[model samples]
Target: MLAVVVAVLVIYKANFPSYLYRYRLQISLSVDGQIYTGSSVIEVVWKCGPKIADSGRCGPTLDGQAAVIDLGSRGAVVATLRTGDTIYPVPHGAVDAVFICANAFGNRSTYEELPALPHLTGRRDLSPSNFPRLVWFSNPADMTSAQKITVENVANVIDSTARFTEAFVEITSDPVVMNIATKLPWFPALKLAQKGKGVLSMPGQFQLVYNMFVGESS
Candidate 1:
């Protein structure tokens, strides 16, 4: 009976819908050795009901692609993504994980065989540079309901044919929070907000893609 009760509760919770999810992330990267690491804080906010779900708008959905290329050296382009934990279901409570990806170039047999450079400790919020900030929105027409911003920092190192660029982005504000109907029939409707950021490092060129999805009410 105890086991059956626990299983039933789990099933009940699974049906609940989370309308807003926010991610707080910090990342570091190095171009010389091709190393990247990051951590994230995930939040689940205000839930909505079937009426809103049927309308085809619910919560924020984020998706994008980024790449780093070194034009000076042949076969020196490496793009990687490392997430500490499985990012599904957006856990309701606080959870932490360590994420890192190592890329090997030249004669290196494998990423593990790459030599470590203790002297190449990556820096955060480095001096700004002329590197351009590029962003693409999946659905600009639908984003009229919410507010967004992008804060970026870049460091550039140039020597001979190679130029290394590292970038960090911070998004701190969203003025127009989404107000949606509640999933629970009794409680009044509530508000939901979402935000995101990213980091990248490369020897030649770097590109950052930002996408934001917002729910709207009629």
Candidate 2:
């Protein structure tokens, strides 16, 4: 009886509350009015509990150069080369969802949280009610020499238009759930924020917008 009880306890500890979380977040980048869908992977590191960060790999990965933006307490933004002269801004923020790289440049980065555009809704199956849409921006022209230099040095231009906006979405939720959609295979856990409420399991498709800007590089 003692052995059986111990085995049962172990099984309960291992399987209770599901032991894993899942999320999926996506962002689209628009430049000069032309839109390009950005790709990213979410990474969850155990910091007390599950904390999510950008995989540091953005679509259009370029070969020679890299750019870094300081997000202050929020964290930092790292840009990597993808295609052409584009450097994609992959923002890293704190658990609180605040932008941390305040000192990385002189000019201020602009942000906007707007309803997701209709055509960009990629997931056809999920209902629209489950997700809330938002957008953010980091204009390139407004970027200081430090910001531009880091990005330019990278062989590819950071998708300055939509710098680290997608990652911001999942992190902003009251009870943040990273990658709620299984977009990335690795991070299959939801990231809860503020200890707000119980996990939410809703069915719907939601759209988000992230618009970034950078003046034509000199």
Candidate 3:
């Protein structure tokens, strides 16, 4: 009876599958003179699901392809796109952008121009280049109620994932704050604010800060 119980426990543990969690990246973009927010999910899938081989590493290729889905509003169907290489999701309201990491082997190219999405360009704002982890976009057009709803939905999906070590926020004030944050040893930092000294002195402003602990699997 003891032997049978132990066997059952071992089998049960072995059969249990490890669940993957998603990472949420929130980017703040200026749409039609108003600041809005959006979110996207990052998923890392193993090249050989649950299979082990003698190759030093048994994880997904860091340079492999990834998917970015845009959650629509009011339970609408989400819009998704496939990236050629592993790209990070930087969700700027109205303008959703992706960032491809610099590879030691070669560099990846992206579209020089933004995609043709409604209410994206006019209200879009550019994300800072200092931190390669975060990406932002601006749209000149005013976002409709529907667009805002869709962006919020996307945020919900991203917030549910559990696969990243750090996240970023868009600080709209002075670079001093950014400089100070990066100096901290706790975690790495990324800045998504627009150019100029505009972000330097805005007190009590809604500075976008990421919840870094969200997607940790520990």
Candidate 4:
């Protein structure tokens, strides 16, 4: 049963729009001596809301980059790692970023109120929602060589963490994406400001493999 679901997920990944990403989340965690992997996919609304009007009036687009992963609960495909949340801000946001990486469910299962109930293999008859599992915001315009070092260092730690084997996510880009990497040690933020883009893969045999896009929201 799990295999069928996973297979469907793989197909979904291949079929999502190339310009606009379908939300995709990949998580791995170690509980006691057990290792577990989790993944989900959903449609993301990257329209930037009413900011873009038919008349040409538009809100300033956000300029930021984030390196966060599922600390594990559940959201939908492509809708998992959001770039701009209420707290993260959209345009003219902060520059210095703070990376907070973790295993999808490394240690946060105690709060599930209904763990006792049967798990829903498929959310039958459910209305899809939009939200991010984890996200960090930073303005590339404000990044310093120092901040870059910090971001790289943090990414290293998370990738090498005892239980966080590998992480995955999907996002949208205005311009066609140019790079994608799943195996590398450095955070490929490419300077989080406007038009900045690059792949951010994790380190070691287990890497992050982030997709970097240029231009705007697709």
Report the number of the highest-TM-score candidate: 3
- Write the residue-wise lDDT of candidate 1 on 1-218 in tens digits: 99999998777554544433232233334435554433223222334233343342233222212222322322222221211123443222211111111111111112222223111223233222211122212222222221211122112222222333444322222232322111111112121222122333343322221211121221
Model 4 alpha-carbon drift over 4 Å, by segment: 1-19, 48-162, 170-218
For lDDT, candidate 3 versus 4, the one ahead is 4
Displacement of residue 180 (Cα, Å) in model 3 is 38
Instruction: Give the worst 10-residue stretch by lDDT in candidate 2.
Output: 209-218
- Between candidates 2 and 4, name the one with more favorable lDDT: 4
Assess each prediction's global lDDT (C-alpha) against the native: 0.26, 0.23, 0.25, 0.28
Ordered list by TM-score, greatest first: 3, 4, 2, 1
Better of 1 and 2 by TM-score: 2
Identify the runs in model 1 with alpha carbons over 4 angstroms from their true place. Answer: 1-28, 34-36, 52-57, 60-218
Encode model 2's per-residue lDDT on 109-160: one tens digit a residue.
Answer: 1211111111121222211222112122133222221132222222234334
Estimate candidate 3's alpha-carbon lDDT, on a 0 to 1 scale: 0.25
lDDT of 4 by residue, 56-105 (tens): 22121212222223223221111123333233343222121111111121
lDDT tens per residue, model 3, 132-209: 222111221111211212333434433333122222422121111122122222212222232222333234322332
The estimated TM-scores of all candidates read: 0.20, 0.23, 0.24, 0.24
Regions more than 4 Å wrong, model 3: 1-19, 41-53, 56-81, 84-218
Error of 3 at 174 (Å): 32
Candidate 3 root-mean-square deviation in Å: 19.6
